[model samples]
Target: MAEEELKIEEGGKKGKLMIIIIAAVVIIAGGAAAFFFLGGSDDDMADVQAVEGQAGAAPSASTGSAKSGTALYVAMPRPFVLNVPGAGRDRLVEIKVQLMVRGSDSEELAKSHIPLIEGTLLQVFSSSNADDLVTEAGKIALREQSLRDVQAKMQEIAGADVVEEVLFTGFVMQ
Candidate 1:
């Protein structure tokens, strides 16, 4: 009878150990899943950069002169960092934005509004979160908003149609 009790005790102990191991594995797996599915971190930045192509390669647009003017090339710097709650504190990133401005000379228009454009972009990007800058659709919306902001700022600063289209040269989430 003592031997039998010992056997049963051993079995019970083994069973408990097995349950503990299974529970540990499940917890580990659950943490991994949460880490992957939750998204928004340094890892997500890779996905963002991959989707965006080379920086500062904006296509030239025709600048209808008072008579006939040629288009010009312009390169603008995007916001540096976008702070978001999901990616730990504030995450820092560097971006370059390409733009095609239509005017007597695209270069001149782009140049004149560079400061205003930069400031507006910095303001907009500073306020944005990772969610706001995620996905192609989100980027498109951001571009449209940027165009409006730049054009409005140009009208205020240079009193002209300084920007035509806002293009993303470098877009990253992290």
Candidate 2:
């Protein structure tokens, strides 16, 4: 009976040891994962701060021309509304666009040409078909076309590609 008691005690000690090891592993893994994800966010925050600092420095560096290696974004004052041809009836489409430029000069240039840009965008939007706007590829194509037109116009006015990209902030079709 005494030998049997000793064996049972040994088995209990082994089971307890296994549970302790497993718990230790789980806790260490959780800590590692937390460290990995949380550490990444700090890096992201640092990157954002660096970019902001650069943007702030850009305007101070140059007045007439934009500083190299900086990005600027300007939003249009109003959305563009147009009627697109549909299967049976006309579909109304509204889009809000933002202009991505390289520097302060580009941003100012874009702002100065807002009216001309809006008119050009309206012409492009009006030419689009209702069915084409529904698909992802169609939306991308439309954006590309708009960007090309805007850049062309900007080149004519500013003698440079003031507008880098046309970003669609909002799009609705009904």
Candidate 3:
């Protein structure tokens, strides 16, 4: 009876030992999981800080670009009117615009090409109907044609490829 009681007590102690070991393992595993998923302290935020610094350094590069635009503005000509085809019957029938243009080639670039661009635009606008001069789609189409016409005219006048883009400073239809 004594030996049997001793064996029973030893079995209880073994069970308690197993419980302790399991609890310790669970605690260690949970701590490791927490560190792996949610404990990223400063390394994650460093990337964002570095990106902000890089973006801050770019303004100096853009500051000089505004000065270059002064010359472009001086060379740009008057606004041209495109009479909408369907506009005769509608309330808003005209696309009035002022163009800001530049050249593609440095040597071929000439401020004098503004007249040629204006002339080409006058012809292009006059040929377009109301449907081609009204609405968002019409506006985009007109802008594209204006760019093409200006570039073509610039090439013809300077005897080389010139004119980059035509910006619409004033775009209104009424």
Structure candidate 1, residue pairs in collision:
65-69
Off by over 4 Å in 3: 1-71, 87-109
Superior candidate under TM-score, 1 versus 3:
1
- For model 1, give the 10-residue run with minimal summed lDDT: 59-68
Per-residue lDDT of 1-174 in model 3, one digit per residue for the tens? Answer: 999999999999999999999999999999999998987768778986676565442222212221122223333445565545564553333344444433122312445555666677778767766666556787688778877887666556555434445556666666
- Better structure of 2 and 3 per lDDT: 2
**Top candidate (lDDT):** 2
How would the candidate models be sorted by lDDT, starting from the highest?
2, 1, 3
- Listed in order, each prediction's TM-score against the native is 0.52, 0.64, 0.46
Cα deviation of 146 in candidate 1 (Å)? 0.6
Ranking by TM-score: 2, 1, 3
Error of 3 at 83 (Å): 3.3
Residue 77 lDDT, candidate 3, scale 0-100: 43
Instruction: Residues 1-174, candidate 1: write the lDDT tens digits.
Output: 999999999999999999999999999999999988886798678775654333322332332222123334478744455555445455555667877754344566677667777888877766666655666776777778887887777666656555667777776665
Supply the TM-score for candidate 2. 0.64
Estimate, for each residue in 6-121, the C-alpha lDDT of model 2 and write its tens digit.
99999999999999999999999999999987676767889987987766644422233344446888999999888899777888888999988776667777888899999999
